[model samples]
Target chain A: MDVLLTSTAEAFRLLFSGNPEIWEIVGISFRVSSMAILAAVPPALVIAFTLAYGSFPGRRFLISLFNTFLSVPAVVIGLTLFIILSRQGPMGDFKLLFTQTAMGLGQFFLCLPILVCMAHVSLQAADRAAWETARTLGANRLRAFFTVLYEIRFGLTAALLAGYGRIISEVGASMMLGGNIAHYTRNIPTAIALETSKGAFAEGIALGIVLLFLAFVLNSLLQYVQGKGSINP
Target chain B: MIENFRIGFREISKSFGSNQVLEQTAISIASHDCIVITGNNGAGKTTLLRIIAGLEKPGHCEISLDDASPEPWRRLRKRLLKSVMYLHQQPYMFAGSLLRNIEYAARLNPALADRESSVQKAVSWAGLEGLESQSAASLSGGQKQRVALTRARLCHPQVLLLDEPTANLDSESRERTLQMLREFRDSGTAIVIVTHDPGVFSDLATSKLHLQDHRIQADDIGAADVVELDSVRQSKKR
Candidate 1:
């Protein structure tokens, strides 16, 4: 108990004392994760919208496939990308094996399914009348699509927050793809792992606090957005 | 004001899986026309209206405009979408102020030179004054229906297809909706209304049709009361 308390206290000290190294790892995590989620959102929304609204062959199969991807372990994705991006692999021409771009690529795949599946669920729960109403009101198909999106804006925001939370906190993918290099590719989760393994409990605990605080903030945001949309849902 | 025009949709066929909802049914709408359609639930009354509005894909259909040569429905669908508007049984209000709802329709109408005044006038025309800033989604059934008409009023669609415009309204709301509809028809906007209570629209309905056997037929006025309920159920079973 004393050890835990001591490390936790020192962790806050390091966090608030303008620790450059700790903040750099935090910056890498956010930059990679933010770019990944931003890149994943548009394509995920299109896929989810197609699954929810379009009627075509294999649509149901595609929906099921995405839902299945939601449960896939992050390590599995990390390993798959690692092979594909390795020196001898098909994509090896890029030579992006142990870089921030690799970490971003891993996180992108990790969050794509999450955004797709969750957005699909939100669109499914949306009122069909929204689409019909927009069409009848002289909106073209594209305008009508945007109208429906606006109707379910709160739900989509929730999906976005959930996707960001999952990718940012994931350790396995960042560690495997980013290689946990000191100040270059290192992120919060990778740094936590390295610090803990080196018996540097204070550093690990500080990073854990950041993750925990982030989880709390994201969940609070989710709850607030859900409350705004609870009536529609 | 809408331009004087006529549209004839021939051979509208729509099916959901094995269920044949509409089978080569036909209908026509001309300027200043009020066509009322009556049928039991699942008789595809709404489907026919939707097809006329170009909001649904038909198995096959053809459209002829103003004595012109017949063209495939797929070809004329864009024209129909531009000129026709369909109102739902329970009107859906966008997620914002009532003013925003009216503003949306005004924005779609490129011909409207002054959108601000046009929208304001429409709000007053629908008796929706003092409620401009309120969330439209929170309005009562009657208020929502009025807002829908207000939107229709702004766009000036050549044809308006409404599904049960007075389904659950009290007498006051029904009267308000009928008054607005009467003005729409007078302004040369063709009106197609699908209702269980066709009697309410008796004054304005220029023609009445019954949906039966997956077809639209000129309704025999007295015969409908006796044969409608049983025949509709029988047709569903077929």
Candidate 2:
């Protein structure tokens, strides 16, 4: 307990002192994860909307496929991406292995199912009249789609936060794809893993604290948006 | 001041798996026309209107415009959707304020040069004077109906299709809605209303049609005869 308390206190000191190394890891984590989510959101929303509103054969199979992917272990995703991005594999020609781009790609695939499933649920819950009303009001197909999306903006925001949280905190994919190189590819989860394995608990704890803080901020924003959506005021 | 326009949908049919909703339903609409359609529950009145508004894909349908050759519904659906508007039984107010809902419609309409003033005028015309900033979803049913009409007015659709526009309104609200419909018809917008209570629309309906057994039985009474019939019905009610 004494050691834990001392390490936690030291972690705070390191955080507040603005240590360049620790902050660099934090920045890389955010940059990679932000790019991943930004790349994933549009396609995820389109897939979710199509699943919710489109009438086509195999749609049920596609939805079930996504739902199944929602539970896939992160390490499995890392291994699969590692194989594909490594030399002697189909996409190895891109030379993307052990790079931040590769890490972002892994994170993008990891969060896509999450965003699609959650957005699909939200779209299903929205009123059908919202789409019809927009069309009748002279909006084209794309405009009507956006109008419905705005109607369910709060729910979609929650989905986005959830997807970001999952990808940002995930360790296996980032570790395997990024190789955790210092100053270039090392991120929060990977750094925490390396630090703790080396018995450097203070750095690990500090990084852990950042993840926890992010989770708190994201969940708080989600709850506030949900309250605004459900409550009249 | 509106240009002469007419739409005729012929050989319209729709089926939901084993249940046939509408079959070979036909209707003709023109500018300055008010068509009130009445039918029993599950008689496909709303389905027919939706088919005309291009909101639903019929089994097979053809559309004719202003004495032109009839074409497949698919070919003319885009034009129909642009010019036609359909209102729900319980009108849906969008997420924002009443004024925002009106403004959304006005923004889509190219004819409205000044969207803000047009929306304001529509709000006042719908008798929704003070509820501009209030969330539209919080409005009463009658208020939602009026907001839907106000949006329709702002868009200036060539055909306005309404499904049970006054289903749950009080007498005063019902009278207000009927008055608005009369004004829409007078402005040369083709109005098509599907309702269970056709008597309420007696004054506004240029033609009364009944939906029965997957077909529209149109009662093509002359304008003077319809006025006389309305007076007799009103006197009988009193």
Candidate 3:
């Protein structure tokens, strides 16, 4: 208990003193997560919309498949991508393993199912009238698609936040794929892992605090979007 | 003079599982025709209009516009979509300013030399002028209906399918909407309205179609009702 209290106090000082090392890890975490989420949203939206509105033979199966992917273990994703990008593996010539790009790629996959699942739910819950209304208003398919997207913007926003929240706190994929290389690919979650393992509780606690703050902000944004949806309706 | 064209639907049938909504229904509507489609709930009056508008496909249905080849309808839905407009019972308000909604429809009509002016004219015609700056989603039910009508008018569709258009409007809004419909008819657009409110449109109808038990209960009114209805309209105008 004494050690925990001392670590907590030291953690605050490290955070407030603007420690350069801590700031770099935080920055890399944001950069990778942001890029991965940006990469994930467009494809996720297209797939979700297709699953929601399309009547093709495999649509139900495809939706179920994505939902199944939503619960897939992040460590399993990391293992798969690590193998693919490793020195002895296929495409090894690119030497992407143990790099930030590989970490982002892993995070991209990690975030995709969350985005696709939530976006699909949003699209499914959207009013059919919006699509038909845009169609009969002489909007071409593309325009009608955008109009439908606008109708469910709240759900999309929540999906984005969910994806960001997942990627930001995820330690397994980032640690395995990124190798947590110092001054390069180390991120908040991995730093917490390393610090705790080394018995440097202050650093670990500090990183955990940052992660918790991030999660709080994302959840708050999601709540705001949900409130907006209800009030507008 | 407005060119006369016919909207034809042949043997259109649609079903969800074993529950058939529309079955092998045939309708041929001519220009300037004002059709009042009446039925109890779930009678598929709206479905018939949707099939004609090409927004929906019957399990097996076909449409031919006037003497035009079926190829045109098959090949150019995006380009020719302007020829048909459908108004929902509760009009959908897109997430934008009302003026943007009107402008979006107006952009589709290539014949409109000036989109802004035409949108303004449509807003005035539909009595939706001052509401232009407001978010359409915030409008009352009557205002939304008017905005929908304004969009349909701006598109200048030869055929307008209205699904229970006056279902929730006050008398004044209904009268205003009816007057707008009269003007559209005068300008040679065919109007097909699906409604349960016969009293609201009994005097304005050129033809009445009654749907019952998933079939055409009655089509093309008897001559006597048409004559009486016309005289009633004439008397009201005077």
Query: By summed lDDT, which 10 consecutive residues of candidate 1 chain A come out lowest?
Result: A224-233
Select the stronger candidate by lDDT from 2 and 3.
2
Better of 2 and 3 by DockQ: 2
- Candidate order by decreasing TM-score: 2, 1, 3
TM-score of chain B of each: 0.91, 0.91, 0.86
Candidate lDDT (C-alpha), each? 0.89, 0.90, 0.83
Best by DockQ: 2
User: Per-residue CA lDDT of candidate 2, range A1-233, in tens?
Assistant: 99899999999999999999999999999999999999999999999999999999999999999999999999899999999999987999999999999999999999999999999999999999999999989999999999999999998999999999999999999999999999999999999999999999999999999999999999999999999887655
lDDT of 3 by residue, B77-147 (tens): 54335578888888988777999888878886788898888888888888776888998888988888888
lDDT of 3 at A115: 92
**After TM-score superposition, what is the CA distance of residue A152 in candidate 3 from its true location, in Å?**
1.4
Worst 10 residues of 2 chain B by lDDT: B225-234
lDDT of 1 by residue, B77-189 (tens): 89888889999889999999999999998998898999999998999999999999998888999999999999988888999999999989999999999999999988989
Model 3, C-alpha of B33: deviation from truth (Å): 2.0
TM-scores for all candidates: the values are 0.95, 0.95, 0.89
Error of 1 at A194 (Å): 0.6
Evaluated with lDDT, which candidate comes out highest?
2
Worst 10 residues of 2 chain A by lDDT: A224-233
Off-target runs (Cα >4 Å) in candidate 1 are: B221-238
